[model samples]
Structure formats: C-alpha cells, structure tokens
Target: MKLAPLHAAKAAIESMSGDQVLHTVDGHAFIPMDDVWVVATPSGPASFNFNNLPGASPELRQQIKDVCRALLVSAAPSRASQALTAYRVLIRFLAEEMPGRAVEMISLRDVLRYGASLKAKELYKLRRLKEHLLLWVDLGIGGLDDDLLIRLPDLETKHHEVGAAVRTLDPETGPLTDMEYENLLSAIRNAFTEGKLTTSNYTLLMLAITLGARPLQLAMLKCGDFTVSARQDNSKIFILQVTRIKQGKGIRPRTIFRPRELAPALGTLIQQQCDEAREWAVAHDVAPEVAPIFLSDRSSINMGDIGLRGHHSGKSMAEKLRRLLKDLAVTSHRTGRKLHLFQSRIRRTLGTRAAAEGHSASVIADLLDHSWIDSSLIYVETRPAMMERIDKALALQLAPVAQAFAGTLVMRQDTDRGRIIHTATRSQLESVGTCGKHDYCRLAAPLACYTCTFFNPWLDAPHESLLDSLLQEREILANTADLRIAAVNDLTILAVADLVRKCGEMVGRATK
Candidate 1:
C-alpha cells in the first residue's frame, strides 16, 4: 500500500469502527497528526514519505525545530548524554527501521535486539518508553490501530534474568551486624549535630526506619500531619499521621506511633533542619518556593555559581542516601558483606530489626505498607535452624514432667468439679509471673505439696493429662512430611510430655 492518499488516509482513519480511530497521521489511524509537526532531519527525510503527510504547518514545524535544538543544547555535548543524543539517533533510525514493505511499520525484532544490548534495568525502562510512545501514537499523533502490529522477539530467558538484574540493581535487605548498626546510628547523630542532614531527612530517615516508608511518601509529608501534644496528665506524645501510602487502599492514610526510642531524637532533628533551611533561604535571598524540607546543603554550599540557588528534589534525596552509604562503606551483613547503596535496603533493614524485636506482625505490615500480611511475615518467619533451637529449648524445659507420667497419664481428664475444666494440662510452662489468682489462692503455703494437701491432687491430675496430651501430640506430629516445622513440634511436644509426667509423679509421691 503506497501510503494512502491524504484525504483517503483521513477517511480511512475516521471510518474505523468505534472511537478506536480518533484521527490519522501520515497513513496511520488514531494518530492526532495535526497536534504536532515533524522537522525533517537531513539524516533521514525519507521517513516522512507517507502519502497522507497532512503537511506540517510552517509555524508548528519551526516550533518543533526550536524544541529539538533546545533539548540538544541543554543535554550537553558529552558521552554521558548518550541517551539524549539517542533521541536524535532514534529519530533517524526509525526512518530506516520502519518496515520497508509496510507503511508505518517498525521492526520489533531490531528494537528488541537493540534493547537487549542495554542492561536489564535499562531494557525495562525502554519498554516503558515504548509503551509511552505507543500511547502518544494513539493520542498525540492521529494513527491507525496498529498496536498489534508492533512485535518483539521472545524473551524467555530474559524474563528470568530481569528479576535477578533487579535484585542486582537494588538489594532490599540482608542481616545487619552490631557494628554496622551502631555506625548507622553514629552517622545520623553526627549529621544532626553538625546540621549536615536537615531535620526533615533525619525525621524522615527515622520514620522510614521505623515505618519502612518510601521516598515519595516521605517527600509528601506535611508539617500539619504531625500531631505533637500532651495527654491529660501533661505527658508529651508525638504521633505521625501518615496521610498517604503506596500499597494499601488508595488514599487510606494510616497513622504509626513514633517509637519511644525515637521520640527524643525526632523533634530536635526537625527543628534543626527547618531552622537551617530558613536561615539559608534568607542568606541566599532565594525564592522560598523551591526550598522543600529535604533540600540538600550542596546547593547552599555552592550558592554563588548558579543564577538561582539549587534545591533538592525527591531524586536528589535518593541520591543522597546512596552517597551516605558509599561514604560509610556500609555493607549487607551477609556472606562476603557486599556493600549496598539502594534506598530499599534501608527500608528493609528497618523492617527486619522490628521483626527481630518481637513487634506484632500486623503492626510491622502496616509499617512496611505491605498489601499482604504474608509479605510482612517473611521478616519474622523463623528459619529451619532457628526453629530447631526453639524446639530444643521447649523440650528441655518440659522434660521432667513428661518423664513422670510417661505411661500412666490420660489424654483427657474429667476434673469437672463443675469448674469449667477447660481441658486442664500441666505442661512445663515458661514462668510469666504469678498466676492471676496468686494473691487469693488458699494454697499460698506451698513448700511441700504432700504437707500442704492443696497442691497435690489437682496438680497431679492436670499434670498427667498434660503429659499424655504432649505424647499424643508428638506422635501425631511425627507423621508430618515436612522436616522443619513438624519435626520441631514433635521434639518439643515429646519433651514437654516427659516433663509433665515427671511433674505428675513428683506430686503423686508427695501426696502418698
């Protein structure tokens, strides 16, 4: 099809079923050709040979030329600006890359080959750009419904490598050794003392560590969102009302209480940074609009070089975090202890520490802004080795009681004394302070159970039942197919049963 005639191109596009064909550009339907004008580069003017060219208006074409020139100048003339240079290179490539046998056709295989040559992270980015360009083809330039025509070679292996490359690009977490943890603390303290990090970043880092917040969410934090006040008794408390989150219901803000550990450091950090920014703004005589709370000191340090004072953006804040880790030589505390510089690593560390400390999983999930509880559970899930240790400890503590009632115990006891028996059991339990009825118990005099009489019968009954229950539970547990959880439970249950039996015998003999 030699490009459809100008009037025919417009008619073909306009005639397409439904709103799918919004307009036509060149010979492509659904393209808003009139919205833009192409300034033919001398390198490849033949790219514009579509019959329905809709001829560019002189003024619009001039504007496009001006835009192209301005972009070229601003991008600088260096190897570092290759991507910017590629904007022009790509325009030229498109002329020839387009399928010669078909109008408005581009070689997806070549695009994929070109994309594959770039790094995995870069390839993902280009794919997004490709998607954007397709959108523009549909909306910006009136174009035919040719989305299905665009194709790329299969990337079966590339799909798997993409994930690995993402991890390489940014490792979210690894263990943190004691020294590294302390070093992070030290850097933060020094930054605060020297006014090197602003209060916003300090509070933000603390909040990020405490709540596992993202950079965008941190950037969006407003001063009014902080609720600093005192209780009826005048005790001070500061609450951060997180108004926006990424993972949960859209716009469903969740508030996380500031940990007591961070309360002392937070207010001072915020005020120190805010005060410094205000002072800097006044000193430089710069407009306040650009000075956000997290602006860096680099611009303040070199205010004389630029016409307008430099200010920080969200991108700069992320870069600053990378710089901090680089300066500190911070590494993931794993095998080889490889250095990590990504902001996601920082968030993960915060979450991992919280999980290790026994905070509620739901709270951790909220802090991390995880959409699923299972994702948050990963932080606290005990590994097989750790679970084995827990099993050993539980068994060791319950051994004696289980041994005493090894055979004579019953799994269920009818101690109904109408007392809501509730399946009484006397497993070797960890001491959690006096039972709720401790003060009122008539058997407070408890040196020898036989002599006291109050501690023997009831204790032995429950003790026997507990041992029997544990043994039965262990027997059932042994049938578990998985080696980790079931094995641990089996060993732990058997140990507890033995301890219960031992405790039962001890009480029975005391009574005898």
Candidate 2:
C-alpha cells in the first residue's frame, strides 16, 4: 500500500487532545501509536506555526534550533522519523503535564522529575536542556521563575563513593610534595645550565617561576625591562621592570626590586642577546631594535623554500617553550611544547610561601592577579590538620609562653615585634655570616630552616616592608610578645616551624 503524505498525516492529528498524540500522518488527521514508541522518540518538526508558540523568544528558538541541528547531524533517516514521533509525544505530555500553566509558573522540581526518569546519559542531555532554558531567561523568555535551581542527584552512584574516587586522583591534581617540587625545578634549571635553552629562554623561565609571572606576562618582557646594579660589597641587586605585568592592569610601574639573584642572570642573558644581535646587524646592516629577545634562529625558521625573513614572524615562542619542556621530561598543561616543570612547582611554592608569610588573602589575590581573593585561596591548601591545631593553640597567645622559655633561646631584646617573630634588615639574621653557632649553621644551609636559631631573613621581609625601618628595634616586652623559634615543643615556635617544614617539603617535591 502507498504510504500517506507526511503533511496529511500531521493534519489528521490536529484534533488530538492533551492525552493523545498524532503518531502517524494518514490524511488530514493523525493516528495514535504505542506509548513505548513515543518514549523511544526524541524530537520532530512543529505541526503548528513555530512562531505561534505561546511564549517562545528569539533565544529559545535559537536553542531549539541548536538541539535540532545536533540531533539531525547524528540521526539516521529512521532515527529522524522516530524523533519526529517523540516531538509529538512531548507536546502531548506538556499539554497534560501542566494545563493552563504559564511558562513562568513551571518549577525546577517538575522539570527535574521529568528528566530523572530518563536513562543516565539521557538525564545529562535533559540537564543541558534545562541550561538552555536558563539561557532563555537571560534572553527574556517570558517572565522567568526566580527560584534557585535544585541540584540533581548523580544518577550513576552515591556521593560518598564518588568522593572516594575523586580522592584517589587527588595526588596528581593536588599540590606536589617537596621532593617532587625540587626535582621539577632542578630538571628545568639543568635544561638551562646544560645549554639546552638559549639565554633568553633560561632567563624567562627563572623570572616566570620566581616572580609568579603568567605565561603571557613572561612572553611580553623586553630587554630594557630589567636593570642590575652592583653594590659596594660586590653584591648585585636585580631590579625588574615588569612593564606588561598582568597585575599592572596595562600600566607599567616605575620600578620594582626583584630578588638579588636575578640581576646577574638577567645581565648575562641580555648582554648575550644584544651581542649576538649586534654581530648579526653588523653583518646584515639591520637596526638594533630589530633583534627581538626571543626571535627564532634562522636555521629553525621553516621557510617552505622561501627566505627565512618572510615567514619568521610565524615561529611561536610558546611552541618552542613546549618543545624545550619535552626535552626536559616535563608534563605541561599548556598546549605548546612549553616547559611545565616549574609552572606548577613555582606557583605552589610562591602560594605556600605567601600564605605562610601571613600575607592577607587580598594581597595574594593582587600578587597572583586573581579576580577574587577566593581564587587565590585555592593555592593555600597545605597542612590543613596543622593549621587547625595552630588556630586552637593561638588562643593562649605567645607572651606567657615566650616568657616561660626566655633563657631557653638567645633571649635577644628587641622592640620590633617583627624582629622578635622574624628576621629584619640591620638585624643579626640579615647579615650573611656572623652566626658562629655551627660550621653548618641551620640558617645558612640550603632549604634547612628548622634547626636555625636566628629568625630567617626571608621571614623578616614582610615586616621590614611594612614598618619601613632599617634596624631591628631592641626592646623586651614580656607582657606582649611572640618570639620566633624553630621548635616543635613551643606553640609559637611551632607556627614558624610548620612553615619551615612546609618549605622544605616543597623543595623536596621539586627536587624529586
């Protein structure tokens, strides 16, 4: 028998009520089919004018079209026919589901229950539909409901089981252990020291890690952006000119003092790059500014038989960085073969250090260029159990505790509360070599802060930055003072001790 026309079949089902759907076109009206067939179908073309729908908006229509497109792209001819049947089913269901209910009156609970009854993956698909509805609200689809969306239960398993499974993967995503951190850093440094990377790349990596620079920020650094000056004691201070800093909000600062070690390294990198560029310029008669700090070498430049200068701009530095990382056996989150040995290692280190230094969340947010302090808080995820203990112990304060153990330590008199708690400028700890405590003094040992009797100079940085003082004040106020020491037995000492241990642990992880 000849099949009925599709439009004729649809027209026949026009009179069907809320409980009945036009399953097949057979003339001017439609015929009802098995409920199971309706359940198996998913979508269809509208029988009535789509624009005539009671509350459809431009965005809602767009969403419907998108879903239709996705379905059409994946659907077979038979599946498409079945989907048409399902659309009819949905219309019938909606009619009976909420009679006379305006679009705004539809609640999340109703939508969720309807969705939850589907298969697991289908349930997720329905959730996507709900999200589309949310977008519709933004696009002014009727007067939308203001109630909060109820979270759907995970259809696959219980919450406890899911959490346990997640915890199993935590070691990879969570902060690295000290040894792992140190190994990663060492590997990256070795790549530089062994001459695997050019001077510019080496300098960039160091600055990026040490100063917590993002990839884009590191890429934008220029030759003139840094300065190194020699001190009278034959020491050098590196002053970094971070013109394109992410946190600077596009405005360059006049100058900022970087760590003392950066000066010489930067000088070497800059001079090498400049000297090479100068030699090249003399040979080719090119301008000095033409030599970008990170320009690709002519040999590596893919010319496709064309001259290197023609396609030189296309060589991506980020891609080169990724290749360098592979050479160093580093796993990267970035797409280009960029070295990630220090990306995670350095951020975790800085985050842990800044948090331990008693820097406020806002300060960290600024340093990290986080849009919110809440985002920065994610980095301060070390030693949770210890922090809880410290919080409780701090209730007793440190004055009485310090007085009780006075003679146990050096009992140095200092007016500066910071000096009592940490090393400051013009203080004994700030000096390089005055402590005659040991041949291998704890303070002088690399990555060994626990055995040190003196307050670590690094710890005193925040205090000096705050007070703007040169000398550590000398005053003894037993009534109110918390002494700095690296002992586990004392609570006040435990705080700093915790930091030292954590720092050591971080170093250990990088090394591993």
Q: What C-alpha RMSD separates each model from the true structure? A: 18.7, 19.5
lDDT of each structure? 0.40, 0.38
Local error of candidate 2 at residue 454 (angstroms): 33
Cα deviation at 436, candidate 2, in Å, is 31
Clashes of 2: 37
- Give all TM-scores, in the order shown: 0.42, 0.36
C-alpha-based local distance difference test score of model 1 = 0.40
Q: Weakest 10 consecutive residues, lDDT, candidate 2?
A: 35-44
Residues 1-512, candidate 2, lDDT per residue (tens digit)?
11123223233433445345332211112223221221111011223223433443445333333322222222221332433333333333454566774333344564555566566545554544443344333233232345523232222321111222112313443343332333345555546645677676676565556666554344434344545677999887765454323232212222342222455755676667656655665576655543334444542322221122211222243455455545766432212122344344455556655665567768776666555676666545332122222222341243232221111122123222332233334445442112223244323232223223333333222322212221111112222332211112232232233443334455577689
* Candidate 2: regions farther than 4 A off: 1-170, 192-195, 229-236, 243-263, 274-291, 297-318, 330-345, 356-358, 381-512
Looking at model 1, which ten-residue stretch has the lowest summed lDDT?
A: 40-49
Q: Which stretches of candidate 1 lie over 4 Å from their true place?
A: 1-134, 137-140, 143-179, 186-208, 216-225, 241-262, 275-291, 297-311, 329-339, 354-365, 370-512
